[model samples]
Target: MTTTLIFTQLTIREAQRRKILWVGLLMGLVFLALFAVGFHYIVAEMDKYASLEEALTITGVLLTAGLYAVDLLVILMAVLISVAAVSGEIESHTVDVLVTKPIHRWQIILGKWLGFAILLTLYILFLAGGLMLIVY
Candidate 1:
């Protein structure tokens, strides 16, 4: 368990060193900004012509669409991160060091997964929080 935790910490540090977190954050912020501007214009237009109930329904639908986009973004990030992680290490021969170590291979994989999961959770929270703020 301690070994797994060590690998987990290493994986997170590696991601930080690569600036994956910063890139994801920057992209998420840009997405939120665009969503906010578009949502504002949509609400303004709806207010001009939509009844209260209709406006509320449309807003709900728009919010759902925005969430769907966020979901897709999360999926894409996970794929990009996971798909490259092991292969990238192997390609650069970095995995050789871990392979020779006493650690079980599963530990490395699990640690990477956990690290990426943590990152993705934070990413979703940030994006969703910003979206909610924009809507409400």
Candidate 2:
């Protein structure tokens, strides 16, 4: 219970402090714009194709590629965010204050990891949702 609370608080604080939200929003907008442009091009090309089946197949392939691209973006962001979490705090000496608390060192580390994990999970969900919106 204590660990969970600590993790939740840390995650909330990090989310409020970092540029993750803005970066995510911008990435999502860009992804949607790209998907739109890609879909338009695919549709045009499909019209040139001889068979309706071939057009649908090509469209499906393009959509799959877009979905994979979105997943890659999400994974990249997750790695970047997690990589920054502990190292950034330590570099800024923010961890020092937390270390002085009554909490154990291991608890602090675990809490931070859990916080980053939660953030990554949310980021993945957002990316997946955006991809679904674009594809469907």
Candidate 3:
């Protein structure tokens, strides 16, 4: 438990130190910023549809497009982060230090996994919150 928590925290910190987390965060912010600009244009375009049904149709189309774009980014981020995480330290031979630790191998693995999970969660939450801001 303690080992897991420590590992998880370390993993998150490592990602930040390595700038992977920053890249994801920066990407998400860029996405949201672009979305905001697009949303403004969507609102502007909606003005052309004064009828209730037409306005709704335009909004639905625009919103769906925005969602699709976000979906692709999220998926890309997830895949890239996971792949890098699994092989990152190992490829650099940093895992050797952890192997010397008294902790069980499983605990070490679990800790690292937990850490990446937290990173991904934070990334997703940030993007989701941004999306909510755009929607609401």
Candidate 4:
């Protein structure tokens, strides 16, 4: 296999070993659950006095609010993961082993980026899908 692919796999494995993926998934699920419960209650109460048009408008607003919160969480996760990915390795001197390898420096950076990008994409998709399902 290519060096970049190897590094990508290594990065993903490290994240798994650290349980970051599991923690993120658990947190996302909890957020979705809470959002779902709150949305159900609010819509039920709104239904009592609100017209159809008002209900639809309020639903849209609630969905948008949920989306905005998800967006912020995703952004925060991406920033935290990316910031720690390289710096932590360097601080722990793990970069020495990597540098001593035959792989080019750019390959390591690109591989780490690809790994984190894949993770973040999956996370975003999961959270967004959950929100959409709950709202619709």
Top TM-score hit:
1
* Candidate 2 lDDT over residue span 39-101, tens digit each: 877677778864988877776787788778877877777676677767887899987988787
TM-score sort, best first? 1, 4, 3, 2
Model 1, 1-136: lDDT tens digits are 8888887888778777776667777888889999999999999999899999999999999899999989988887777666779999999999999999898999998988888888788889988999999999
lDDT of 4 by residue, 1-136 (tens): 3888888888878777776567777878998999999999999999898999999999999999999988987887777667778889899999999899787899999999888888888889999999999999
lDDT digits (tens) for residues 1-136 of candidate 3: 9988898888777767776557877888998998888888877777875677887777777667767777787777767666776577789888788788788878877987888777777777777778768865
The model with the greater TM-score, 1 or 2, is 1
Residue 74 of model 2, lDDT score = 73
* lDDT (Cα, 0-100) at 34 in candidate 2: 79
What TM-score does candidate 3 get on C-alpha atoms?
A: 0.82
Which structure is stronger by lDDT: 1 or 2? 1
lDDT, candidate 3, at 40: 81
lDDT of each: 0.87, 0.74, 0.76, 0.88
Off by over 4 Å in 1: none
Q: In candidate 2, which residue pairs get closer than 3 Å at backbone N, Cα or C atoms, i.e. clash?
A: none
Select the stronger candidate by TM-score from 2 and 4: 4
Error of 1 at 85 (Å): 0.9
Models 1 onward score TM values of 0.91, 0.76, 0.82, 0.90
Check candidate 4 and list the clashing pairs: none
- What is candidate 1's CA lDDT for residue 85? 90
